[model samples]
Target: MYRKKSKAFYERMLKKYPDVMSIPQMSKACDVSSKTGYKLVREGRIDSLKIGRNLFVPKEYLISYLLIRDENNVR
Candidate 1:
């Protein structure tokens, strides 16, 4: 299914990329709109670090967010 494929893709990405990711990269990985990603960053709903002109999200934060979201959906 899509969830399994997405999870596998992320696992591959984690092995290939660094612990931090740019907004665009995060958006693509989560299959979310870039605007939503920016909003999440601005609202502090998801943890991010602003490095000069680019915003970075930690891998840990992304994993936690997905896990929490999955749990909420289950409930």
Candidate 2:
């Protein structure tokens, strides 16, 4: 399914690029709703930075999140 491929692609991109990503992009990459991404940021679950009205999650943070989730089979 699309989720599988998207997740894999994003994982690959995150590992290779190590760049910051917007909330929407992070949501799509993680296959979650933007609201959830925002909640993660707002709740301090996922660390992010604000820049000119946009929130950006660093690739390292995302990768760590994914790796932890994957390890626990939570995502």
Candidate 3:
């Protein structure tokens, strides 16, 4: 017999492997556009690192930022 996975399992997986994402991946996951993601970086609302002209967002920071914004709307 096959078993079904639970929402909690996916949540835990996301939390455990947040770093396994890119800007496009994040845009899709967060329901935002790539342009908006770039704007957020430029506005200093989110943390990012530059490697020659490429920008990388830390997964933990992204997750925490979204969670804080959702909880307190501080941004």
Best by TM-score: 1
Ranking by lDDT: 2, 1, 3
Q: Which candidate number would show the highest lDDT if scored against the true structure?
A: 2
TM-score (all chains, Cα) for each model: 0.71, 0.69, 0.67
lDDT value, candidate 1, whole model: 0.74
Better model by TM-score, 2 or 3? 2
Predicted candidate 2 versus true structure: per-residue lDDT over 1-75, tens digit per residue: 213234565577666443888998888777789999999889987889999998999887887776666666665
Instruction: Assess each prediction's global lDDT (C-alpha) against the native.
Output: 0.74, 0.76, 0.68
Backbone N/Cα/C clashes per model: 0, 0, 0
The full ranking of all candidates by TM-score, starting with the best, is: 1, 2, 3
Q: lDDT tens string, model 1, 1-75?
A: 234225555567666556788888787777788998898788886899888988999887877676666656631
Residues 1-75, model 3: lDDT tens digits:
334444454456467445746666666666789998888878987788887778887776676666656556453
